[model samples]
Target: MKKNNTFFYLCTLLITVFLFITFTTIFSYFMLREGNKASAIKEFEVKEQEITLKTRDKLKIRVYRTKTKTIEEMDIEEYIKGVVAAEMPAEFNIEALKAQAVAARTYALAHMESVGGNGCGQINEGDICDTVHCQAYISKEDRFKAWPESKGNEYWSKIEEAVLKTKEEVIVYNNSIAKDIYYFAVSGGKTESSEEVFSQSVPYLQSVESTGEEVAPKFTSSLRYTNANFVKMINSYYPNSITSSSNLKNNIKIKNRTSAGGVKELQIGKTTITGTKFRSIMGLNSTNFSFVFNGNTVEIICKGYGHGVGMSQWGANSLGKNGKDYKYIISHYYKGVQIGKYTEL
Candidate 1:
């Protein structure tokens, strides 16, 4: 009888063990499937790209990701001929493009979760739609394969070098590792400070004295309009002078308005103007803003693109199209800078 009971117990134990294994397997399979689905949604890369690290002001500059996947869809032969024909100087040998692809891939891998210019994690699409820090994808026509003709290049080796450290440096920028070396874009050929205008800092950047060119100093009213936002900007530098609740008739007036090309003509009170001169007055640049016009009210509009300082994006693209490489293009606008390996940092 005892022997029979032992056999019965053994059978029950084996059956329970087998059932447990079956249940666990099913659960694990479903869990893995869900995990893969999430990755497919959140993970993507710039096909065949490399990256470098840079620091500015107190902030570490994040690798600028192209929202347009120019690599994945590129037809090397056609792309090469298009660039060469445009009289834009580009070296399109199979080897060179392969190198670019390697570099691009390296950079993309390095920047998977890197920090941004604002000392925050790298932002994706829709984060800074109109801002220059992140490039926006204008259309589906944006995709271009990096190197379908050739595999890749030598630069891929360097992609991983500065990425991790570069991310670390960005945190420092947010915490004030480097003093902020902020600048105004063109200053509209001449410029002044909110401190000068309103006797305060206005939370804005410093202007580089005047360049005297009609297109030299780029000033923007991109973030400031109306009575409330204007007050915040003024108060950012000269808080005592501006009040957020004040209306136009009580504390604001349009002064010395000037108009510029290919932009909307705006009339608020007595003056007519174009460009970002309005932002300079209001103390915003691609970041924060507020505007209240008439009883109906209108939101602030950006007059000029970018920070409005030394170089313009459209200007750089034009130069690139007219025979300029990355180095020449970057240096022309930045002035007196070295594009060295980030490893030195």
Candidate 2:
């Protein structure tokens, strides 16, 4: 009995010691994992803070003045003010102007050589041009010359305010400055995707609903051409496409429409062309168009203006009037984009 009791005590001691050792090992492993997780989180926070802190800098740009045929250096913020003034109407909602300001800044930085971008191809030694080829820019003298005396100063001050309020803000996608920043006057009722218009599949430049653009001056327009004249025009661009003007209605057919309801392809006699090419050949405002054959006269009615890609200025104004902020306006037009300080390239 004594021997059995001693053996039992020894067995209990060994079991307890083994259990303690196992528990200690498990606890140590969990503690080490938690510590590693905490370290990783702290490191991420530090990197984010560094990105924020490094955003402050005074940047400059070289602009190619088409009128003077010269390359002039200017402060980037001042250039943005000029761009906002030239690109958007001063009478528009303030929030809309702010959105335009951000877009202009992003566009400028995208072509600026100082920011690791390829300079404009239109110029040999400049960041960008002061024309619609790159972006329209009006100097103080030219702005005053263009605007009425009473409105020039007030309008310029408003544009300056818009630029100052959204200083250095840029549209970023996938952690980089977006290069395809295109804007237009109107979108009819919807904006077009980049793939449909420019043949480039961009993630953020996808089609979306853009309402309240009917108030824009260029929302709807019409061009009239006689049947004979229309045939001449089509033949001028695409030689001998239209042979007969008697059955003009049967000769022309809309091949297909885009996702946003813009004409994607059109069949005119023997020639089938993209809607954009047709718009160019026919002098239409946009690809969203329809024609009516009234007797011998053909009237083409067009909706929207410009390329119909990216943000719509009038649409932004409408959203701003409806109490949407600039950030909201930008996010609505540019899908899945982040607005922040100018990204370091």
Candidate 3:
């Protein structure tokens, strides 16, 4: 009897000890796995910059200007999304980048009707150019097995939060703050005039002005004629900027004039072409310059896309590959002032 009782007690104690050990081992394994996962997230070296707001709120946002990483090397669409997300850094978060992507993509989709050379493709749409006039898009073959953004739970959550917060201003060429946007151009190096800027019209140098600057034409290109949807879309941007097809003149002669804005007045001798002809003869890249003749309105065919503003997109792609950041990229093309944020301005 004594032996039986002792044997039973030993068995129960051993079983209890085994079960305790098993539970502890499983818990330890899980804890270690979670710890490693957290560590891995921390390992990612995402840098950020801080700024003071107009309302005195301080913000810290991640900086995506990777020197060695090209758009091809990284998911460029995601990078751009982050650029516009206007997110300040927080704890273990990658969703803000996607949130910005949705908004940016929305903006792009909405304005896709604009000229090819416009928007994110412009020279200086706020702080981005996509080229020398701006920054750049990711080229082909670089988008390998990468984590691009999507409108998933994480994406939607972040976007909803970002949208509700302060909306980043839609930037335009010449640092123009817009309700939305008027025009965007895919810049090369320096933004040329309409013929150059829109029509890809090469300049014919007439003479060097007294300022030692070669002064030829405010607009050296012909009014780009296009019946394309983008041409028709220009009306929405500059409601006053576009004119009728009657702007086309038969005996049109163009001469450069310096005024509040060059190409201000288009004069065929002295009968100033004030309406659509004014825009046409002056070669100003406005909707008014479009002309209708014999059932076909002369639509100025915009060649290269964009505002022809600051940094060119292609130019930046070349430079970024050659090693440049947002700061170096902007300074190389745009003259004057150092590379610094506009802060509250």
- Clash count for each candidate, listed in order shown: 41, 0, 51
Residue 345, model 3: Cα distance from true site in angstroms: 17
lDDT of each: 0.35, 0.87, 0.34
lDDT tens readout by residue for model 1, 1-345: 999999999999999999999999999999999999777654322111122434233322223235442223222222222222221112332222222222222222233233232321434421122122322222212222342334223322222222222222111112222212222233343233334333345332233333322331233453324556544554655546544354554444434332222222334343443325455454445321234566524456433433433334334444445566544543454333323222211
lDDT of 2 by residue, 107-135 (tens): 88888887667778888998999998888
Q: How accurate is candidate 2 locally (lDDT)?
A: 0.87
Score every model by TM-score: 0.28, 0.83, 0.30
Best by TM-score: 2
Scored by lDDT, model 3 comes in at 0.34
> Which candidate model has the greater TM-score, 1 or 2?
2
TM-score-sorted candidate list, best first: 2, 3, 1
Considering every candidate listed, which one attains the maximal lDDT?
Answer: 2
Note the residue pairs that clash in candidate 2.
Answer: none
